[model samples]
Target chain A: MTVKQLTLPELTEACVRLGVPGVGLWREPVRAYGTEAAAKLVHDAGLAVTTLCRGGFLTAIDPAARADALDDNRAAIDEAVTLGTDTLVLVSGGLPPGSRDLHGARERIADALAVLAPYAGERGVRLAIEPLHPMYASDRCVVSTLDQALDLAERFPVEQVGVVVDTYHLWWDDRAPAAIVRAGDRIHSFQLADWTTPLPAGVLNGRGLIGDGVIDLRAWRERVDAAGYQGPIEVELFNDTLWVRDGVELLTDVAERYVRHAL
Target chain B: MTVKQLTLPELTEACVRLGVPGVGLWREPVRAYGTEAAAKLVHDAGLAVTTLCRGGFLTAIDPAARADALDDNRAAIDEAVTLGTDTLVLVSGGLPPGSRDLHGARERIADALAVLAPYAGERGVRLAIEPLHPMYASDRCVVSTLDQALDLAERFPVEQVGVVVDTYHLWWDDRAPAAIVRAGDRIHSFQLADWTTPLPAGVLNGRGLIGDGVIDLRAWRERVDAAGYQGPIEVELFNDTLWVRDGVELLTDVAERYVRHAL
Candidate 1:
């Protein structure tokens, strides 16, 4: 089954056809097609929404702007609720402009989460903190390791807060396997992607499509499985080159790679 | 003193004049003047050579080429020995090209060290494994944390194996203080620099000139001092902007910043 091109509808349908149990959808697509419409499309296609791509950027210079982010995250929780996506992944924002204090920015993220967690809980959406790669430590995400994420999680109840363990971010971590075991059932989602060469812009464009880069996907999967996480493993690639290609072709390649390597 | 501009000679003389303690000299400068001449120049100027800026790239596809790296490192150790420097800093090379196995590459680094350690020891040069920031994990250095460096060091005697604790690579680490303590006397050298906003290349060229960036230099110095390391703290800045300025001006600025913020 070679997929060539796919829109949201076709992508959803193809997941079912390919026997993929769930799909992790990003915010742009959800916003573009309208959350309700996308939800209906997924439901009609008999596909489960595994996780929402993100909902956090709580670091900002302006207090009002930070509050605005919180409000927007509340809206994201509502959208996740409407889509029946239980996990809302949060990529904590980095330090604001004219500020080099990462520790302070982290505190702000925790404070914002303290406010948003209750709102997310009210909507039955679990807040899953995704610790991005340390490369993103300055400008993108302050939380850069699973241990750091787990440390943050300790501050909240397991039912209200969990963590998204993406292999791309945590694979190089020396304590990764142990951290996963420590996370146990609190591992809200497992994201799969390989580390590619020449990280573009050192941030956004460098994610490798599964099985294409250096990550030992099988080892990561085995560790996660051993940690007792029975949740769906979502293959999330942020490759600009792949996105430029046909979506169906990309999806087909992703599915095939998953079968051969990830599964 | 408000340092604005001064020549390289003036910079070198100032180190002597002020009894600046230690300086990590780059290869180009030393090579241009020739190793013997450069050693005499520094000795005449009464300066202490702390550590050579680098010596590692052992991960190469060809075995002969990889062996060449050890040869180069041997030359560097000779240079360090001639200059009266005891510690030779090693930035463990990243994964080889067309390779995805980071663990394999790390093993290759350990192997390289095992081959070179005896020669370095004979020359009375201690190899200090400087774990670069995790951002350099792919193209530069695989050792990304103090703990990782410590793990590598445990394989050898403390006098033979040491770690360079650079603030830029380690400030974000939650276990930094503990790692510093664990490092104890094996902490070969201490390097200081700040992490500024708007990171250039998302990794390189973003280091702050001491007080200009967000790191708590004084606090870090206190931690290292408390750990019983009374060595000279070298200020290593990879800032292109700073390099474009007069060398003497940069040195004076560094001295003032060290006294004001780092001491």
Candidate 2:
């Protein structure tokens, strides 16, 4: 959500003018702009829809909540299909309210994927399990390592379920490089969000601009390329600092940073 | 540092009155109180000296800074010996200034240990590598996982080098339980701190009181016990809220929480 300030039409127009080839769309903004119109705008502008933002928060303990999550995921899969993107990135939800059963929560994610993966496969959408940084493990996602995500994804068909390798989340992990290699062709979506220090309160929106942090972005790019990932390398940042800037300027800056740092 | 509010003397007196068996001492306070004097105070009060707070920041790039870290660690080893504690917990420092080499930083820690482990062992003290949480990977400690700590610790004799199992730092990792089992007798010190949400600004001092947050402290204690760790289970909390409370009351609460939540 690096340039979240941009409306879908404005984003698509800017992308076309800037020679950007694809745009990954988050559900909220796409839903707000009407997903069909949003998809058409990007398609008419000759830009690919890289990946849908999300599809999973499947750790709800209540039966009703679980059913609602499943329905929401099914809708997400349909939206991905409508957007003509085969990948739906899943920030699998964290532990239920007061529960400390990490294993149980993770198992629940697997159960949700068991039902949703086949449905997504039928619709030509692969659920990309995004293992968020461990700082977010308590309230965001139980899957904190690429190894763990691969463990969960390997249980399902590689065509149905895969992993999203985000540098911000996985850079601290020494095992992640090897895990990325092991992920190989199952790497559905590759994302870049730099990690910066003295994280702002809540630690959710402190993602750095591409070149502002300490990550070896180009190294990550080369690693994923070597791992047989031929997917779009999306810059998916959640930064409060960048969001306040002009959307077109931020998008241009992001494009420049991607080429200079990530490419 | 659950009862950091208590002075060294007050801490020993309170521990004695509360039937607490031992206490872990931080170098700063012990230095302020005079290491020998602090040791005598705890011993005279019939309390065991559990473990020393820290000794490692060995990732400095500059020659002068690296030398200072080694000297300081040597002092810490000496202090641990004087305090009659066999364990000196090491929080290996993070990446050096402006550096993105996490692997290199970790290797520097190994290099430092290669120099200091034997020094501490010669003085009848074992260096306990405490892996700080991954959130601190950028600026605090590069050792972000128990397995990583074990990887470093296993390079030396078990009597000379070992790992600390802290609930707050390791509870997010699914692989930690297995790593603890793998650690076996190399588990030097077992610490208890809970995982709470909406982490504070810097994310350093937000460690929850023993029973206040999401971690299953007793389960960790039991796991370490199963791994053959028969050592002090120190409650180390860095909460700003707890620090402002009455020291005696906080100490009493921590003791009660230890029994109720971590025993």
- Runs in model 1 deviating more than 4 A are A1-7, A13-21, A59-66, A96-108, B1-11, B14-21, B59-66
For candidate 2, the clash count comes to 0
lDDT of 1 by residue, A60-145 (tens): 86979987999889888988998999999999887787676777888888888899888888788889999998767767888989
The docking quality of candidate 2, as DockQ, is: 0.87
Q: Give per-residue CA lDDT, model 1, range B10-49, as digits (tens).
A: 6568787666965677665677668887787777777878
Best by DockQ: 2
Q: List iRMS for all predictions.
A: 3.0, 0.7
Residue-level lDDT of model 2, residues A74-182, one tens digit each, is 9999999999999999999998988999899999999999999999999999999999999999898999999999999999999999999999999999999999999
Candidate 2 structure lDDT: 0.93
lDDT of 2 by residue, B1-263 (tens): 67788898888889998999999999999999999999899999889989998899999999999999999999999999999999999999988888999989999999999999999989999999999999999899999999999999999999999999999999999889999999999999998899999899889889998777889988998999898888888888898988999999999988988889878
Please state the error at residue A76 of candidate 2 in Å: 0.8
For this target, which candidate reaches the highest lDDT against the unseen true structure?
A: 2
Worst 10-residue lDDT window for candidate 2 chain A reads A1-10
Could you tell me the lDDT of residue B157 within candidate 1? 73
